[model samples]
Target: MKVKVLVAAIGVLAVMVLVGCGGGETSTTASTAASGSTETTAAETATSAQPTKASITVGVLVPQTGFAANYGPEAQQGIDMALAEMGVDSGVEVKIITADEDVLDASNTLERLKKMVETDGAQIVIGPVFGSSQQAVAPYLTQAKIPWFSFLGASKDLAGSGGTAFVWPGADQLTAGPLGDYAAKTLGYKKIATLAPDYAYGHDSITGATDTFTAAGGKVIQQQWVPLGTTDMLQYATKIDKNADALLMWLVPSDAASFVKEYRNLGVKIPLLMFLGIFDPTFQEVGDLLVGEIGLNEYNPNLDNARNTAFVQSYKAKYNAIPNQTTAFAYTVMENIIQGVQKSGGKTSVEDLRAAMNGMALDTVIGPATYSPDGIASSNRYIVKAAQAADKTYIWDPIETYENVGAPK
Candidate 1:
């Protein structure tokens, strides 16, 4: 779906008056010529003085099908809502062009992104949700000079001198650091096992966990990397080291649910610690089996800040569903972009928009957020445990907050 701002044509009517002195000989042809010249000049002046209507075309590249299909619609909703709030009446005409980021193939994702910019005429691009997909398309986007706002949290390389500006609402390292610290220092787990999908995100998450865990005098007893799209997690679950103090794992929501179910079925007695995934909405689906599981996130639907409260209320009112991380991050992406656009007076130039966005701070649903010069986001990260609330619905109850967690340097 596309959001477009329609521009109206400006019409200028030029009128000229000619007068003749009573005693002087009058030349009608000369007078008429002078009148015509005066009218032409007035018309030219009016045309030049008219404000130029800025057409801002945004490209949304997301997985509309395959494993990550759920994210596309949720992100779209946030993008739409932000556009609604910005209003077309701001004198900037906006258009949104969407392209599907095919989850299984990086080449296909790259081609779709190219089309968005080369064929669809998008000035700014948002998303290509997964880390692998973002990495696949980053160089091309940078070469094309289109500023990218992404949802992928796994890679910090997406920011800095030669990279696309990242807009991950929360960096993976931010949550991963706290998760590791909590597991090793707070919970006092000495031996932990790690499992995750075999990809950039998996590697990044484990690194984040291990860096802190080891520093706090904990050891990773076992590490397993599952291939993406693996449906049967039973085999991997059976291989988990039962001797470990705890297990730290992450996967896409569906895969995570499958893994947890299999782990229980196999009677793996190790405690579980999670990152990024396994939160409500997902938690609501698997909460009965996931009680006591700990995880980290940037935003929870039940977070008590005024910004978050209003966001949740508005989101439920519009979509009749609770907002998830995808929705919140996508909303923040557009909010930041709109703020930058307004700062630049509707100018969409790469340099102008980049300068406007860099070091910019805004109050988001997750609370106060600021972006670094390289476009890495800094925000609060919450440590949570899965449990049923008084309403019998599953929730991620906030246990602790790491304030103003910045992206990995």
Candidate 2:
């Protein structure tokens, strides 16, 4: 999954998250939120008021029929894990309605979301998973007064005063800016070339790095944007600045596979700085091919924390495998919704829930989660290296962790 889970000729700005499905996507509670006050006291702010509703409905959006279709089942698995954890006796009844994110068509995304809210009575929703889809459906969420908890990632700018949008794991820029810094100051790259899908999430992911990279005294000599559904990379690959120290790339699953295959065949010797998803476990070729390369990671199932420990145990017990980034993002969103409803005494009104739990600290699979007044989120970001596991499968190996990071500087 692209954390941005993005691609398409859609306009910029996209969300559960707005940016990546797997890195090309977005999320937050794996750490702190807002100005960080919620980390220690979000629980204290919960109102002890009595129940206002016996049941709450949550709408979940996933891409079921596009290039990102594989991500749907993973998200569902995460949602199920959260539901099972919430169980049947948590006082508030949780009903779930499903819809396709439809990242390809903004209009379809809006239409489906409207049905979820207007007909199925979803009070809060998770996803509109791609950045473009999130952008397409956000205004509707605001007008309907429903909280949009992005399981993917979201733009900080979209989290305006409506208090209806809760962006987790910060935005694309927040996620990638650190890599910029690392590349400049740590990796000591002097110049770099970049390639990404020509869309909202791609721009944000690249800009996040270029901003920090430029600020840290590195030059981005060439930047290439690929259109959606363009899997053939010969035209783009031939033009890469061979003189640049490295090439940074981000793309949807299929396109990423296509481009890497082309890049390898060309025998380009430039070191690579990949955005997330280049090594997604789902794509065995890219992961195995990129082994030993460095990249940004939104989630690593191996995160060491009691909450994560328990989360991994439960997920493994159920799925017999580790939850990937997309699954973790969905699980975190579901956990937030469940906790918010429980803490606010089953109050599911859009405004009531936002007021009751905005910036509330959550121990999510990602980490501790919190929100800004404008709904921007905070969490952990990781710098990881691609490595092969014992079974010959590829996995992200965390080399460094950035805790409680909010938007980029």
Candidate 3:
């Protein structure tokens, strides 16, 4: 899709007046100045004082192929929607360039990112979905001096001091920590177990949950890691400690659906507490089996607020599908960047944009959010449970909300 340009009325009027005036001959005369003083013309001073119009190239790096491809299109949709809303009259011309960040390999993703910055001249980068991909390309991004707004939820280092000003939608600790507290303190699950894909995100998520759960006097009885793209989860399912109070786990949507089905078939009765992934659009395919499963996330389609309501309505009207976390993340990132650019008088420089973005607070579809000095975002999070209506459609019922959730320091 093309980026729609919406010119401001005042800008249009100015252009029209300039066109009507036509060209007129003018004489350039040097004016006298005092000793040790530099003479400057009124026109020269005015031109020099004007803020330079910014031309920004944004690189959209998401997995358009491989396991995570399902999310890439929606991410793009969100980007387009945000840009359209910000309009082209913000004294900046934004050009979007896209490249696939293949989920199976981080090296390829890094190469693509390097090409985007060095060859495509992308001043800002939006994503490279998976946790490992983000980690691999982080140092390169820092060296390139490109600001990245990532959807990664794995490493705290990505948002730590002295690193690239990389922003995340919501870090793993933000979602997992609250859910862990809810699981142990609220649901009274004293002994828990976890199952997750063996990667940085999985490690971060499990650690976050375990830390919070153990602190609340709960014990983690067992933990299992599944390789990415492992279709048969029966081995892991059979190993789950049935005596545990509950199982906390997450995987990519397809793998998760398959694993849940297999686990259910294996007659594992431990309740499931999920961290992200489960609320994906693919969850509808296994809704009946997933009923009553609890999860935590930063965004949900059913959130009732003016901004979310309008966003959901517009997204559905345009795409004919309900929006998911990926869409929300993409939209929020783009909106934040646009706001930063505006704050800097359309300055696209990495240093200037970073200064403008740090400590910015905005009310987004996910509710009020703020960017920390380290570039991590803090926002409201929801604890949701899957439920099926009489019509047999699944809905994420938000049972609890945690405000201003951020990554652990």
Candidate 4:
């Protein structure tokens, strides 16, 4: 089953890439200084005024082939969509550097980052998609002073750590708060147990959700932390065979499916809820296991907006499938960068680009998004339940919405 699934996934990705790059033009440009933005006296200004280059090079690093590969291609697709819509150019060449986060080890992932910065000449870096990989790469990006836009796991360590790294979405706070509130108020779940990987990403997510839920009068009965890449979660399921109202599960596609299957096998029939990772297409392979399951999304593709609808349609037409948060967030990252470039009139300096990004607010396909100086996104989050109506297709329907956290008004 594993081999067959792996082969099928590869085949699907090959088709998606060709479709993604087809619509976009070859966008690039050279820099020209703003009429009056630089601060310098006449003599000092004469020598200090260096023209703003029109071309931009963004380094996109995601786990395209490893554990987090599910979201990697979707991230690239989002970037491509932004480039097509924004039409940014100035003799300004926008070059993309794609790197794989070999989730098998940290050293291999570090090597990938070094290649992106040194050999690829990617002045701006976009991602290192997994929490473990992000932690491994964070210190290096700090020393290099390279501006990186994080698009993957919402680890608290990345927030306010004071480096070139800026986190999109309040990571743990954004996802967990809305979800916990819904589980408490709407579902009336008095007691819940969280099952997640025993790592920075999983631990932080559980902490964030349980903290918020408990504060809202919901009781967390237990917490289970399993090792990453564990094939069987039956032990975890057996542990949860008790009287909990719901299960807050945090696992990638493979393990998530294992949890669902094991829960059913063990006759543990409580409601299952998951984080953004549940948005992957691979979940569909489990069929009935996901029906009626609740999932929280920082980015929901079902949003009834022009950009979002178009994104969903285009993605479906190309891949014959729907998109998840990974795709939506990835595309948002690229779109934000494109907007910054256009606002800067094709400026290329890392400092200038970062400032422009910080100042500008973006209307994303999902919703209104703006980055705080602390580098977290202030945006709404949605509580979605898996529903399949007469259409015979599974989709996420929103139950509640949460406002922006960790950002100033």
Candidate 5:
């Protein structure tokens, strides 16, 4: 009986061991399967967790249907050119929104800017072409944390304030310094006569010329400020008499044309130096009357650079329109922003894009371009002579190219 009981106990113990081994194997298999499942789920979640799509919405804050309507289509043409170069594909969509800022009143200007920023949700802003409009939009843009760039005559009042706005070609210095220096040093002009519209743009330009010319051992013999849109400028032309070596006229399109017409009529033989606005379509109405005028241009259509040549060809083909200097600057601005976005992996955040813009150095059709945090564009300036093209329209022939005028140190 004792032998039989011991054998039975041994058999019971063997069965128990077999059951425990089997259970252990099953548990290990289950844990391995669970771990694999967990890893697959995590990978799936990661694949689904990418950031949302980015769309580029730029606010064209120019006067499209107001006093500056002549400049409206030109501004739009610039943006269109930039968008084409940027290439809207691979999750980037460029949307341009336009606003009309009435050039007559400050309130209307501010209202239009506010609509573009708040109502339209524009991440970038282009213009409000006049000085007053730019001044009106400054505080709003600063508070809203939106970047604003303008195309107008330089205003020192707009600069040095740590504002959210930047002026291309650096308002006063870029426009006036080079022109003044060229006249003073290269052309050997001792006495310069100045005439510009009585406004911030004209005043700032005159101030820049005055300061730079004086510093470079040149004398400003006489300075005259005239009201804008003055139809009869024979009286002003009479101011450009035998005493002045050269006349630096800084009027806008209409007034400048009038002055040029009257100067020719009055037979004033002194060489005239003027700004970009002096060569607008209206001035071309005066035709060969402005054959020998020497001026500073924003960008010369006849500049024989690879970029300018391509731009002109593309512009004519794409829009069936003649390109101008303002449009060129506008194109440069948009291209600069698009490059910044592309470099940042298409980031939509303003801060990231701003950082990208600050670090960017672009090769523009106008010339080399770079911007500062203060919103100043330190691009090159062009000096050109007005010559009638074979097409019988006035075109600027680039005489000197000051490449990279405002490069940061």
Candidate 6:
């Protein structure tokens, strides 16, 4: 997998658009301006470091327009939040140069990433969120000898390739696999109908669920694949088998919202199991209808651990919105890079950073995370429910936690 999965659209379009960190045509050079927080202390002190460099340039490849647009800004926010916590103003200056990760035409990503590495001098590059975008650009990342990290995740297909790593809770199948098991063993869902956008990520995620679902004695009576970028979900919704135990769906953001409207309009009441669908931005629009529904998530804002508490508080204070998985992962990947630099005594070479980061355990917003040599992350996953909170605000309440979750063997 190349910066393989887990974009905001990793669930819907954010799941599809996801997020990446390569450079592109329309660019913004910026940095974090927020005050210090404990996360800054955590990232810096998480590993031993010498602030050797005054500044480092990071190139971001995220789609600024089209299906994945909802994810890019938040991902940048995550990077900024992490940089601030690492003391951007007070210490190391991290420069951000953004490029559009054109999900439509991936060649654009490769061309722009070249500028990021060659012309702009991005020492550590962040994205190219979609799997196809990552695949198009992987050769250059290796050729340039730039040690890159996925703000989202790279897929399992890119595993063990040089100059890269996948953030576990990454690979789409890994993140959703437990949900398949959960649907069978915990929820006692015996038969279900599945729906997802027809794409690599969509196929991989639903497979993650159904593969385990079937193994545990569940049957998927029907499977639907909506063409990527199709917004008319009513047609797909109308075709679902109402008698199945539940409907499992993963669409891009717009498509997901459209699907919900049609699902409700049709009074399709079989219940729902979604991949990160009932969360923010999405929840902000469809929360009222999704109450009591189940979804799979890579990050939950309600986590109570010290690391997550600090991350959520600091992030909310800075951005005034609950940090979604995109933001959280962006923050975590930045920490991974910064810490690698620190561990290697400020070496920016990919060879050095990769050696430093791989297998170096650290507390992340999503809990314990460590990168394997192949660049796959071993992290955690969540089974969440959309619940109306006391404040009448909608939140993805984590009902279960699966530790050290990674790609299924």
lDDT on C-alpha atoms for all candidate structures: 0.73, 0.72, 0.74, 0.67, 0.67, 0.73
Model 4 bad stretches (over 4 Å):
1-53, 88-92, 159-161, 345-351, 406-409
With candidate 5 superimposed using the best TM-score fit, by how many Å does residue 306's alpha carbon deviate from the native? 1.7
Best lDDT among the predictions, by candidate number = 3
How accurate locally is residue 130 in candidate 6, as Cα lDDT from 0 to 100? 74
Question: Per-candidate TM vs. native?
Answer: 0.84, 0.83, 0.84, 0.81, 0.80, 0.84
lDDT tens digits by residue: candidate 3, 105-177: 6776787778778986888888877787888898898787777887645466775554565556567655578
lDDT of 6 at 296: 80
Give the alpha carbon lDDT tens digit for every residue of 1-409 in model 2.
Answer: 5644455323344432233333322112111121133211222222223232456777777776557776667777777667665544455556666766666666766777787789768888888777787778877887777888876677776675634677777877677887888889999999999999888888888998898899999999999999765768888888899999999888887787777778878988787887654545455667767788888876788777787888889888988987778888787777777777887777776666666666687777667767665666678878888889998877778888777765433
TM-score of 6: 0.84
Model 3 C-alpha RMSD to native:
16.1
What is the clash tally of candidate 6? 43
Quick one: how many clashes does candidate 3 have?
0
Model 3 weakest 10-residue run by lDDT: 26-35
Worst 10 residues of 6 by lDDT: 30-39
- Candidate 2 lDDT trough over 10 residues, lowest sum: 26-35
Count of backbone clashes for each model?
Answer: 0, 44, 0, 19, 2, 43
